[model samples]
Target chain A: MQYLSVVDVARHFGRRKALSQISFSCAAGEMIGLLGPNGAGKSTLLNILATLIAPSKGEVKYGDQGANDGADVRAQIGMLGHDLFLYPELTARENLEFFAHLYGVTDVHSTATRALHTAGLVDRGDDFVAGFSRGMRQRVALERALLHEPKLILLDEPFTGLDQTSTAALVGRLRERQRAGCLIVLATHDLDVADGVLSRAIYLKDGRMVGSDTGSSNLADRYRRAMDRGPRNADSALWGGE
Target chain B: MMRAFFRVAWQVMRKDMTVEIRSREILLTTLLFAVSVVLIFSFALVREGRAPDDVAAGILWVAISFSGTLAMGRTFERERYNDTLRALILAPADRPAIYVGKLLGLLLLMLLVEIVLVPMVGLLFAAPIFAYPGMLLMLLVSGTLGFAAVGTLFAAMLVRVRSRDTLLPVLLYPITVPVMIGGVRGTAALFQAVPDEPMARFWIGLLLFWDAIFVTLALWTFEPVMTE
Candidate 1:
């Protein structure tokens, strides 16, 4: 069954079309990669799915349910975006504890403790996040996203500033969540990471889905060729960074 | 749900308290600023033999109101520095939970600063501030609640705009004038040993009514502003 679906989603910021007639769906436990260039509406689409921004026109459904029931949809999904969501002045443990309370976790202390260990910051859990490196902060953010044990996890460029070890740990954790029947949608510019991490690929150009493939072929090559052959006018405004 | 609200409020307040202890920057700056304002007021008005009873309430509320803006500005600065507020917003909890949490934290900080400033002002100006403890306390509670309630919403809005540090007071002071007047009149009545006066009760009633109205407005408006 489809756990997530977007139909003809369109969004405009002022006069510019940030996303236009975009559509996609994901089944239970599927890891779908959203590949696109800068301003390709990857973040905008992710934002719509995360319910952070409303679609100009379209429908978003979760678990075969309709979009109008947003609270139910929101309860099942977890999101990690480009922004670092943890408080800087707060210690890592305090940050986690705070989020745990926000999400109404039954066992906040234990949940926070386990999250700190998973992020490889067990020793530094009591230290303020202001003192953390980008990698450490990202780990804390990941821990925060997973604290609720959500059913659908949306990640936007989750690999931007991580060391190799941290990256591997994150990938491993993501795979574990995937295996446990969590649907994942990741948006990224790095084809290599997406190729290695995602089981299926969706290419976006000019604020619309341009190509999609599920095979083990070179997705990047296919994506580049698709872009080259695509219409020039389809995405001129996005290319201009409007 | 009330339990959840208070729990989040307590956690937010505790977290801010911990940060305040570590930095001591906001508390120290607001306190010094409040004290200096009082001293300057002494030079400007106290030498005229203006009865302490006449301007005592005005000076006290003005000092706290101005310093309160400084403290409220710091609330969002701490969150923006680490992007923590964004994280809090994204959590599965309701938006009002976050609003109340931050509101409670700001209120606590403003009250704490007032606790120290009230006694210090009395000592500095040699007024009988504690003469009517009940009236003085009533003024503190009503005044601070109104200030913090409106200040929280404005502070959040200003946090996103440029020149937020200066913009908060400029935008906030005019809107808060009625509350200041109410607070001053209420406090002055107490200083004059007129605890049973109807005017003081009327001003206190006005402050309470305004506090309820703005707090609801703040709650309704905060969700859109924060999400946007």
Candidate 2:
């Protein structure tokens, strides 16, 4: 989990190429954002990194190991994809407890209580997830993904259903994780929300890594410039990300 | 490693059971569907003064197979509805353990349905169910295990498919032919006018062999089949 090296990674669905020759590497404490227009393969790249799907042509090395290294390495990884991955019928506490057991977390009862408390849903812990609001569910889902305290956390549109306050809370949580030396890779369209938290933003366009923006201020402007000014030739998608 | 594997399986089974107990969605639906199938046969085949000879075995297996398919579809449908299967797959626990847990849960549901359907078939068709209860129980357990082993795998594979409801039985029945044959033949031998204990015992052995093979194959393939 010290280094995530995606080397010449490509994913093709039958004849259609979802990603090609994309390479990037990041270390602990770095929060990298995958930024692009829709269908730019942001989610595809995240799936590849999460080991949920295999890349067609390259390797995503989680430190010195990869998906072929067996699932013991997965204990260091956590993911929140497009699906919330929660059962609506189960209470929030039940959901957390079930997952905690799967992840082999100790002190199941107290661990679930702590997760519910972190989600700010301790009072509603006994309530079914079906009855919870979208933001509430999102918060609980995030806590569920983090239950095992994974070093590598992949999030896709983590702010989608959040209000302004929840968004701030999420950003704060990400900051805390970042400060704790966990690597966070996220694909999000909310540039303003991500502007301050991301150390580097990787731009992808048409299944290739087009450019990156590492500047601190005016993220929206930088993103526009990166999207518009990048070379459009076949070979120009090649990028050496820090 | 064995302890961890079984521990995860037990937790998964417990979770499914808890949900089932509270909702009873799969259990109630499966029980009613099975009873309806048996009742249809009772009305259609049972004559004024006599029941069709050996119709009991066919009726029992048919009801179990049809209702078991329904229960499997509903059970996995609940998982795919919220994409919970993906969550379960993402866990660090052994993937085969998840498969076993689901199979165990489905087997339990089908067994509960069989508990009612078996006696109903006996009373209506005048089959001597209690005469060979021990042999009959072995046939049911082995037959159900083999069926569930294959059915659970296919049901899980179809969860993300658009036409999963129409597809489960289509895939399950063909692969579980051995199980159905053993169950029907074995149960028939016992319920006949002169119970053939040896025949029933042979079929039970064959059913158990099929169970081991189906479960091993299912466990080996569950991870790959489930993967995207």
Candidate 3:
């Protein structure tokens, strides 16, 4: 019954429209993909979902609770964005433990250790993230975001730069989370990896929702087709991401 | 609720201190810069081994404020570097608690630098060394608290801004005038050949008042300013 609903959400930045009339809803146990090309406002939508920014218009409801419902609402949401949010000066374990503590996770030491194991960085847990390769840091950051077992996870470009092996590992982990019944909303250009894993795809272009459906097919082709169409002709189906 | 707020604040402060302990980037740069400021003024203002009247106190505060800006600049730079501020903003902790934690961390760093700075100014400028230790400590703490209360807020506000390095001082120095006046005047009264106990006490009282106002304002506005 838990769900996230966006009602006519729009965000603008000083004469520039980042997102406009965007509307969708995703229920728990669903994984929705925000697919688009550059400047598609995918990151903006993700930021709005994470409560990092407010929409200039409309409202976002998290199971009848909004972001203004206070810190408790934020506690149930986790995010991973372009920055990775990990301190390079801190060791991998330290980074995880720090976030675990902030998230009010009990038994922080063990939680961080478990996260290290999940990231497959148990051997390199003590090493500073400054020296980590892109894929390695990405994995650690992903675990950091998941440490609190958040009910909702917002990720922007979760798989930006990765090798085939790392990409496969990340996809597998995401699928595992999907099975755990955590609602996930990710902005990704890695359509090939996201193809069938997503329960639905919401295609956006120039700050508007262009297409959306329970399209469990070749995402790249679907994305191309969606982008080629006009907004008036595109499908704007609003579902609970069931 | 109070316990949770304080705990999160302590965690944030401890994390900053840990990073400083490991890196020493801010501390070393700030300490060396403060000492250099003191020494340069001692040479420029002192003549025949005698510093001009009230110059030592002015020199000390100028050093503190200039070096404090440098220190405060680095406080959020680390967060801005990796966009850790985004992570922090997304945390479930009360926004004001996070501000308090950052202020606490900055206060400790400023006090550490002042420990070396005060004595160095005394020795170089021939100011009274042991006139009143308690009064000097109170002035330092109150002045630092007031100054850093404003600095922390501005630093947080400027984290995502461009040309922030050039902007921090421009924004910081003008806003912290009352704090600087209270600090310099209070310390001068203490350093004078005839220690003006009542005069130093007045400035200390004034600085404490400013501390209350700045801290309250910063805590109140922190959440809104940071929300973006």
Candidate 4:
């Protein structure tokens, strides 16, 4: 089975440290929740893992291979970032078809059609994304990320702006995919959602890993404890607690 | 691997074509800008009591340059609004394929406008460009390719910059002087009351050289600039 290992990863934006000395490892069939406050480097970590931006230090590896500056490793990772990355002018089907070709999908049309169905956008496939409501656009973006059927999925704040029905629908799809042995990482501030969906939760604050909950219990409470402990003098305690 | 790269590039171009066909936004705006520039030049030159043909090459290229910039700007503006550039970069394909794909799309749109602009210039200014159709075409392709090569790179680079629309021409025009000069001189030789075959050949050679150098650079630099 495939697995991901990120060791001592650090990223700096000029003099500002965005992420520092972050390390974690997870195998396929596990859903990890990346929980953090604002500016806690959730997006930066996902970006590094997605290979959108290189880490300033350390490494990200899949199986035994490093996330080198090549398309081979990136081919296995799917990311839905803060930006939806969908063309508003293109219909949802067209957007999926275009991305399918880029990912070298064997049959662009059939694959795109399947993805549209998965996102529950089959009826709305031909409508321009420009007119889509926020929930609909999010669904299209989700389909676009899944269009290539990547092995590792990283979603940053995927639940944002989603209504109850849309959120439930998306969560069900994610659960289905996770059960299929795909490794998933979700970054969100919603502790309730994180508690409900994730098997483990990794907490980050001020560019450092505060703690991680591995026992699959009290994730929101543990997350609050981790965040409240703060990083000034609690680093050692946090490590020992983990 | 090369086949895959070209295939990705073709898909990107095809997607752009489909979008442009449906929206008609880039095509109409570029055409309107090109025609407006030509008409405005015609009136200005007529007021100066100058035969439009005497300066036909300059007018034609200026119109092409301005309109091409407009087209390139709109092309990325759409990408910016939807953050689709990130999607393009995230694709599991060769990085250069994306640049080549966008360059091809821009070239096609620019050519579509030139198809109309060329005949109008000949009819309105009596430049006799139709007298040397093959030579005129050679000059146009080389020059436009060179311009597109550099313009496409800068446009992608400036996609996230605050003042990208204005910054593109400011950055692009300076770097592309060689292409612009070569194009204007080549067209001038063709438009002269007594055409200069040797002069046109020299400028065409320069234009081709300019294109070769810039396209190679764009292919090499696109990955780094865009990813960062």
Candidate 5:
């Protein structure tokens, strides 16, 4: 079943067209990478999918439900962006507990502990996040995002600040979540990570998608070629053909 | 629904208190600031040879009101610093639940500050703030509710602005003048043994009206502001 869908999605920040006629869909148990360079509307699309921001035009749906059912839709979705959404003064356990409660988890302590263990922070769960290394903090953030066992996970640049070991661990964890029937959409500038983990990839340039393919090698080569094209008319390529 | 609201409110309150317990910066600073303001007022009154009764209520409300702003600013600062405000908005609870939670938390802090200020102001200025204890408490509750409602709204709005620190007070003070005026007068009436004074009743009604209107507005507006 298609778990997520977006059609004709467009966003405007004042006068700048952040996204125009963007359309896509994802099914259950799929791992897709939204590939793009800077200023390519990656974050904007992620924000719209997460329901953190509204689009100027278009419809986004989760399962069969429309995005206007924000609170209900939000219940089934979890997101990790570049920002570490945990409190610095809070311990990893406390941070997880807080988000768990927010998600209306009845057994907050147990859920939080499980998430901490999954993030490989069971030992450091008692330490304040302020004292944590960047990689450890990212792990805690990942745990927070998964606390509710969301059916759909949206990650925007989730690999930005991670060390090598942490990055591999995160990828492994994401793969495990995908295998468990959660639809995962990750937006990243790192092609290597995308090539390794993503089953499908979509390349975006200048606010429009240039190419989308399932094979990792083809997608990476097409993404690089599009990037090398050096900022041409994105609208003419992605939307004009459509 | 009430259960959900209270659960979120209690959790937010607990989180805020834990942070305050760990840092002790907000409470200590607000305490020191409130005391200093009272002291300054005392000195000015003494040098001018004015009776404590003349400005006692003004001094108390001024201290409470200004310290309330400091408390609100700190609340938003903590949320913004940690990105917890965004996390709260994304929570499953209804939007007004977050607003009420933050407002209740601020009300508690404001009451705590008032508890400390009432006695200190009475002692330092030699005015009997606690003379009509029940009436004084009522005045405090009414005034604090109004302040918290408006302050929470403004704090959420200013959290994202470029000049939020200065913008908070600039936006808040003008809007809160009526509450300040009504609070000081009502408090002064209580201190002067005029429990049934017509002016005190009028101000109390005004304060209550402001509280109801702003609390409703804050709850409605907080969702958009927090998301934005």
Candidate 6:
């Protein structure tokens, strides 16, 4: 019955604020799409949730526990960021086996094989990832994320570099996981992809949450209207010109 | 929990070994670099009328310290390429296990390189390296352990820095001064035409102490530094 919640979390890198006063709560079976343009802090928020970096203020609670309860929270979270996080020199199977051990997965060989098959890389399992195409590497990365069956999956720009076929495979797998009661947070700039897959969409602009709803409407239109405010900060160069 | 920790460590080390087996990049580069440096030192140090013992120890450790840096750099370079380090950090495994696994991998490479370098040095310099076999082994193991322990941590720390290639040695050398001193002093004692047993023991103990302290600190700081 526990849920993941973010309460007034803010993160700043020196003078630049990456996120501010972002608040939300999500439970299992919710596929929340984080919609934002470039520099909108979507990735930062996901990273915070993943505990890769801590928020500067406020708190993130997983169930009743907070970020300070590191291991328990980390054990249940899986993240795919801009970095593929796959070792190029390691074969796909080897990569999975190594991470399987880390995640305390028993029967590493079987788990790796199943994950590879799911990603459609079973035949190429023994091949070094260095030789893989960008799309292929992305598939392997997706398999790595889902290998441990984490309760929360954070996908930041997961669709990048993926072809239509691979993208469909990823979307299908994501939907399947959600149906199995996994909490998924997908952060992307592609409203079309978000529209097709999300149960709810949250729009962010300049580190602030502008709007969030479960309405069945055009996400792009909603995004534009939510961002109708001219500029949140006139002096901030990010919104200034360019 | 302890069993899981070591299992994760072994898996990491095994993965590194498998990748190394395929490419042999770190092995080839570190060996060639170490041998080349030693050969250069042998040529430069041949002054008329003195035994190789006089300069052998200093030159040997110099080769190792420099080439060991290269090995350390290569060990972490692959992780940096695809951001695999991030994956390792994100894993539910203990972060310090990653350090131990990498330390063991570097130790394996360093020991392998030394195996060749030691015999090659003995042949070239005509020094009786076998004079104090036990002491020599102890010194080499302790020194390499200290080096790899600290080097692995620094290498991981520098992975995110912009000037990491240059920063590694800059940060590493200052911290590893005690280990280098112990290695060089111990080697000097052993390489002497007449061995100094007590001097060698003192440096060996120093190397052990250095390994104990830095490795403990490395374990303590690895998670924080890596996560940051």
Clashes of each: 0, 0, 0, 0, 0, 0
State candidate 2's DockQ.
0.65
Tens-digit lDDT string for candidate 1 (A128-192)? 99899988888898888889998889898988987788788878989999999999999988776
Q: Per-residue CA lDDT of candidate 6, range A39-155, in tens? A: 888988998899888899989988887776766778888888778998887889988888888888888999999999988899999998889998888888988988889999999
Off by over 4 Å in 3: A231-242
lDDT of 5 by residue, A1-242 (tens): 88888898988777677777788888989999988878788888988888878888998999888767867888888888787788888899999998888889989999998988888888999999999998999899988988888998889898997878999999999999999999999999888777768988877777776667787565567788767753476554334332
Once fitted onto the true fold, the runs of candidate 4 whose alpha carbons sit more than 4 angstroms away are A215-217, A232-242, B48-53
- Residue B163 lDDT, candidate 1, scale 0-100: 92
- Model 5 fnat? 0.58
State the displacement of the C-alpha of residue B104, model 6, in Å, after optimal TM-score superposition. 0.6
Point out where model 5 deviates above 4 Å. Answer: A218-220, A228-242, B48-53, B193-198
Worst 10 residues of 1 chain B by lDDT: B45-54
Share of real interface contacts recovered by each model?
Answer: 0.53, 0.64, 0.69, 0.75, 0.58, 0.73
Output the number of the DockQ-best candidate. 3
Interface RMSD (C-alpha) of each candidate?
A: 2.2, 1.3, 0.9, 1.1, 1.4, 1.1
Tell me how far candidate 3 lies from the true structure as C-alpha RMSD in angstroms. Answer: 3.8
lDDT of 1 by residue, B1-228 (tens): 778767866777777777888888888898888888888888776655554556777888988998889889988887887556766666666676677777787777777778887886676666677676876777788888888888888888777677998888888888888888889888877666454467777888899898988888888887677654
What is the C-alpha lDDT profile of model 2 across B1-228, one tens digit per residue? 898899899988888998999899999999999999999988999899479798899999999999999999999998987778978888888999999899999999999999999999988999899998999999999999999899899989999899988888888899999899999999999999999999999999999999999999999999888766
What are the lDDT figures for the candidates, one per model?
A: 0.80, 0.89, 0.89, 0.87, 0.82, 0.86
User: Which clashing pairs does model 4 show?
Assistant: none
Candidate 4, residue B155: the lDDT equals 93
Instruction: Provide the TM-score of chain B versus the true chain B for each model in turn.
Output: 0.91, 0.99, 0.98, 0.97, 0.92, 0.96
Docking class of 6: medium
> Which 10 successive residues of model 3 chain A have the least lDDT summed?
A233-242
Please give the lDDT score at residue A45 for candidate 6: 91
Report the C-alpha lDDT of model 5 over B1-228, residue by residue, as the tens digit.
789878887888788888888987778888888889998988877654445454778999988888889989998888887566767777767878778878888898888888889998777766676566776787789988998899988998788677898988888889888888889988777666344466667777888998888888888887777654
Minimal lDDT window, size 10, model 6 chain A: A233-242
The alpha-carbon lDDT assigned to residue B46 of candidate 1 equals 64
